[model samples]
Target: MIIKRVIRSQNRVIVEGKNLVKKHIKQGPGHEGGIFTVEAPFHASIVQVLDPVTGKPCKIGVKYLEDGTKVRVSRGIGASGSIIPRPEILKMRATPRPTVAGPKDTPNESCAGEDTRS
Candidate 1:
Protein backbone atom coordinates (compact mmCIF):
# COMPACT_ATOMS: atom_id res chain seq x y z
CA MET A 1 0.00 0.00 0.00
CA ILE A 2 1.23 3.50 -0.80
CA ILE A 3 1.44 5.88 2.11
CA LYS A 4 -0.45 9.09 1.40
CA ARG A 5 0.55 11.03 4.48
CA VAL A 6 2.32 10.71 7.81
CA ILE A 7 1.03 12.27 11.01
CA ARG A 8 4.08 12.52 13.22
CA SER A 9 2.28 13.74 16.31
CA GLN A 10 -0.26 10.90 16.23
CA ASN A 11 2.21 8.29 15.00
CA ARG A 12 -0.25 7.35 12.27
CA VAL A 13 -0.28 7.23 8.49
CA ILE A 14 -2.88 7.42 5.73
CA VAL A 15 -2.33 4.67 3.21
CA GLU A 16 -3.98 4.28 -0.14
CA GLY A 17 -6.67 1.59 -0.31
CA LYS A 18 -6.20 0.64 3.33
CA ASN A 19 -8.24 1.00 6.52
CA LEU A 20 -11.25 2.30 4.69
CA VAL A 21 -14.14 3.62 6.80
CA LYS A 22 -17.47 5.28 6.33
CA LYS A 23 -18.06 8.77 7.72
CA HIS A 24 -21.49 10.25 8.37
CA ILE A 25 -21.87 13.96 7.81
CA LYS A 26 -24.73 16.11 9.09
CA GLN A 27 -26.44 18.71 6.98
CA GLY A 28 -25.29 22.26 7.68
CA PRO A 29 -25.09 25.66 6.06
CA GLY A 30 -23.79 25.33 2.50
CA HIS A 31 -23.04 21.67 3.22
CA GLU A 32 -24.59 18.37 2.12
CA GLY A 33 -25.14 15.44 4.41
CA GLY A 34 -24.37 11.86 3.39
CA ILE A 35 -22.24 8.86 3.98
CA PHE A 36 -18.77 9.06 2.52
CA THR A 37 -16.02 6.48 2.27
CA VAL A 38 -12.69 7.69 3.58
CA GLU A 39 -9.27 6.35 4.32
CA ALA A 40 -8.56 6.10 8.04
CA PRO A 41 -5.27 6.57 9.79
CA PHE A 42 -3.35 3.58 11.09
CA HIS A 43 -0.33 3.10 13.29
CA ALA A 44 2.96 3.47 11.43
CA SER A 45 4.39 0.41 13.17
CA ILE A 46 2.10 -1.85 11.15
CA VAL A 47 3.54 -0.63 7.87
CA GLN A 48 6.99 -1.25 6.43
CA VAL A 49 8.89 0.51 3.68
CA LEU A 50 9.35 -1.59 0.54
CA ASP A 51 12.87 -2.08 -0.80
CA PRO A 52 13.22 -0.89 -4.37
CA VAL A 53 15.78 -3.52 -5.33
CA THR A 54 14.09 -6.54 -3.75
CA GLY A 55 10.52 -5.21 -3.99
CA LYS A 56 9.81 -6.54 -0.54
CA PRO A 57 8.94 -4.98 2.79
CA CYS A 58 11.99 -4.45 4.97
CA LYS A 59 13.24 -2.50 7.94
CA ILE A 60 14.95 0.80 7.26
CA GLY A 61 18.39 1.78 8.48
CA VAL A 62 20.20 5.09 8.31
CA LYS A 63 23.57 5.24 6.56
CA TYR A 64 25.97 8.07 5.91
CA LEU A 65 28.08 8.35 2.76
CA GLU A 66 31.74 9.38 2.61
CA ASP A 67 30.67 12.95 1.87
CA GLY A 68 28.55 13.01 5.08
CA THR A 69 25.25 12.72 3.21
CA LYS A 70 22.67 10.66 5.09
CA VAL A 71 20.35 8.13 3.37
CA ARG A 72 17.97 5.33 4.26
CA VAL A 73 18.76 1.73 3.35
CA SER A 74 16.98 -1.58 3.60
CA ARG A 75 18.07 -3.86 6.44
CA GLY A 76 17.10 -6.93 8.46
CA ILE A 77 15.32 -10.02 7.03
CA GLY A 78 14.67 -10.12 3.26
CA ALA A 79 16.60 -6.86 2.94
CA SER A 80 18.48 -5.80 -0.18
CA GLY A 81 20.66 -3.08 1.44
CA SER A 82 19.68 -0.64 -1.29
CA ILE A 83 19.48 3.10 -0.72
CA ILE A 84 15.87 4.35 -0.59
CA PRO A 85 15.32 7.64 -2.30
CA ARG A 86 13.07 10.27 -0.78
CA PRO A 87 9.60 10.60 -2.23
CA GLU A 88 8.79 13.58 -4.43
CA ILE A 89 5.91 14.64 -2.19
CA LEU A 90 8.27 15.05 0.75
CA LYS A 91 10.33 17.59 -1.24
CA MET A 92 7.27 19.67 -2.15
CA ARG A 93 6.09 22.49 0.12
CA ALA A 94 2.40 22.64 1.09
CA THR A 95 2.30 26.38 0.63
CA PRO A 96 4.74 28.17 -1.62
CA ARG A 97 6.89 30.95 -0.12
CA PRO A 98 6.24 34.50 -1.29
CA THR A 99 9.11 36.19 -3.09
CA VAL A 100 8.07 39.72 -1.99
CA ALA A 101 7.88 40.77 1.64
CA GLY A 102 4.49 41.60 3.13
CA PRO A 103 3.41 44.37 5.51
CA LYS A 104 4.33 42.22 8.51
CA ASP A 105 7.96 42.14 7.40
CA THR A 106 10.40 44.77 8.67
CA PRO A 107 12.06 47.11 6.20
CA ASN A 108 15.54 46.07 5.05
CA GLU A 109 16.91 49.61 5.42
CA SER A 110 17.98 50.77 8.90
CA CYS A 111 16.34 53.77 10.61
CA ALA A 112 18.46 56.64 9.37
CA GLY A 113 16.84 59.25 11.67
CA GLU A 114 17.57 57.27 14.86
CA ASP A 115 20.54 58.39 16.97
CA THR A 116 23.50 56.00 16.92
CA ARG A 117 25.40 57.16 20.05
CA SER A 118 23.55 57.32 23.35
Candidate 2:
Protein backbone atom coordinates (compact mmCIF):
# COMPACT_ATOMS: atom_id res chain seq x y z
CA MET A 1 0.00 0.00 0.00
CA ILE A 2 1.10 3.56 -0.71
CA ILE A 3 1.33 6.32 1.86
CA LYS A 4 -1.53 8.83 1.64
CA ARG A 5 -0.23 11.52 3.98
CA VAL A 6 2.90 12.31 5.93
CA ILE A 7 2.87 13.60 9.55
CA ARG A 8 6.44 14.74 10.10
CA SER A 9 5.96 16.18 13.56
CA GLN A 10 4.95 12.79 14.99
CA ASN A 11 7.38 10.98 12.67
CA ARG A 12 4.61 8.96 11.08
CA VAL A 13 3.03 8.52 7.67
CA ILE A 14 -0.56 7.49 6.93
CA VAL A 15 -0.56 4.69 4.35
CA GLU A 16 -3.34 2.82 2.63
CA GLY A 17 -3.50 -0.42 4.51
CA LYS A 18 -5.13 -3.70 3.55
CA ASN A 19 -8.22 -2.84 5.62
CA LEU A 20 -9.59 0.10 7.60
CA VAL A 21 -9.59 -0.50 11.36
CA LYS A 22 -12.44 1.18 13.21
CA LYS A 23 -11.47 3.02 16.37
CA HIS A 24 -13.91 4.19 19.04
CA ILE A 25 -13.44 7.28 21.18
CA LYS A 26 -15.27 8.91 24.07
CA GLN A 27 -16.63 12.28 23.07
CA GLY A 28 -15.37 15.19 25.11
CA PRO A 29 -17.37 18.30 25.98
CA GLY A 30 -15.87 20.43 23.22
CA HIS A 31 -15.33 17.67 20.63
CA GLU A 32 -17.70 16.19 18.08
CA GLY A 33 -16.19 12.71 18.33
CA GLY A 34 -17.39 9.31 17.19
CA ILE A 35 -16.21 5.98 15.88
CA PHE A 36 -13.96 6.79 12.95
CA THR A 37 -12.38 4.70 10.25
CA VAL A 38 -9.03 6.29 9.63
CA GLU A 39 -5.85 5.35 7.85
CA ALA A 40 -3.28 3.91 10.21
CA PRO A 41 0.24 5.25 10.47
CA PHE A 42 3.32 3.28 9.51
CA HIS A 43 7.02 3.69 9.99
CA ALA A 44 8.35 6.68 8.07
CA SER A 45 11.22 4.58 6.71
CA ILE A 46 8.78 2.26 4.95
CA VAL A 47 7.07 5.15 3.15
CA GLN A 48 8.46 6.34 -0.16
CA VAL A 49 7.29 9.02 -2.57
CA LEU A 50 6.53 7.85 -6.09
CA ASP A 51 8.17 9.23 -9.19
CA PRO A 52 5.71 11.26 -11.23
CA VAL A 53 7.34 10.28 -14.52
CA THR A 54 7.52 6.48 -14.18
CA GLY A 55 4.89 6.01 -11.43
CA LYS A 56 7.29 3.85 -9.43
CA PRO A 57 8.47 4.09 -5.84
CA CYS A 58 12.13 5.10 -5.82
CA LYS A 59 14.66 6.99 -3.75
CA ILE A 60 14.51 10.74 -4.34
CA GLY A 61 17.56 12.48 -5.78
CA VAL A 62 18.30 16.18 -5.44
CA LYS A 63 20.07 18.32 -8.01
CA TYR A 64 20.95 21.96 -7.60
CA LEU A 65 20.25 24.59 -10.25
CA GLU A 66 22.79 27.10 -11.53
CA ASP A 67 21.42 29.67 -9.05
CA GLY A 68 21.75 27.16 -6.16
CA THR A 69 18.11 26.06 -6.02
CA LYS A 70 17.64 22.40 -5.14
CA VAL A 71 15.28 20.26 -7.19
CA ARG A 72 14.09 16.64 -6.89
CA VAL A 73 14.45 14.11 -9.71
CA SER A 74 13.59 10.50 -10.23
CA ARG A 75 16.02 7.61 -10.67
CA GLY A 76 13.59 5.49 -12.68
CA ILE A 77 15.17 3.59 -15.57
CA GLY A 78 12.20 4.36 -17.83
CA ALA A 79 12.06 8.05 -16.88
CA SER A 80 13.48 10.94 -18.88
CA GLY A 81 17.14 11.17 -17.85
CA SER A 82 17.51 14.85 -16.99
CA ILE A 83 18.40 17.08 -14.04
CA ILE A 84 15.10 19.04 -13.91
CA PRO A 85 12.21 20.27 -11.80
CA ARG A 86 8.88 18.53 -12.72
CA PRO A 87 8.31 15.87 -15.35
CA GLU A 88 6.59 16.77 -18.61
CA ILE A 89 3.07 15.40 -18.79
CA LEU A 90 0.60 16.20 -21.55
CA LYS A 91 -3.06 15.72 -20.49
CA MET A 92 -4.90 15.63 -23.84
CA ARG A 93 -8.43 16.07 -22.50
CA ALA A 94 -11.33 14.94 -24.70
CA THR A 95 -13.58 17.85 -23.60
CA PRO A 96 -12.38 21.45 -23.69
CA ARG A 97 -13.14 24.14 -21.06
CA PRO A 98 -16.31 25.54 -22.74
CA THR A 99 -17.92 22.11 -23.06
CA VAL A 100 -16.98 21.20 -19.50
CA ALA A 101 -18.84 22.19 -16.28
CA GLY A 102 -19.43 25.88 -15.52
CA PRO A 103 -22.14 28.16 -14.12
CA LYS A 104 -24.89 28.29 -16.81
CA ASP A 105 -26.25 31.84 -16.70
CA THR A 106 -29.82 32.14 -18.07
CA PRO A 107 -30.59 35.45 -19.78
CA ASN A 108 -34.05 36.23 -18.28
CA GLU A 109 -33.48 35.32 -14.61
CA SER A 110 -30.24 37.25 -14.02
CA CYS A 111 -31.46 38.63 -10.67
CA ALA A 112 -32.80 37.22 -7.35
CA GLY A 113 -32.97 33.46 -6.58
CA GLU A 114 -33.81 32.15 -10.09
CA ASP A 115 -30.98 29.65 -10.41
CA THR A 116 -30.08 28.62 -13.99
CA ARG A 117 -29.16 25.03 -13.11
CA SER A 118 -30.53 21.73 -14.17
Give the best candidate by lDDT.
1
Residues 1-118, candidate 2, lDDT per residue (tens digit)?
Answer: 6657767688887777734678897888988778988777766887665766666676667878799977886666665544534534324544566744456754544666777689
TM-score of each: 0.59, 0.44
Per-candidate local distance difference test: 0.91, 0.67
- lDDT of prediction 2: 0.67
Candidate 2: clashing pairs of residues: none
In model 2, which runs have C-alpha deviations exceeding 4 angstroms? 1-4, 17-38, 76-118
Report the Cα lDDT for residue 50, model 2.
Answer: 70
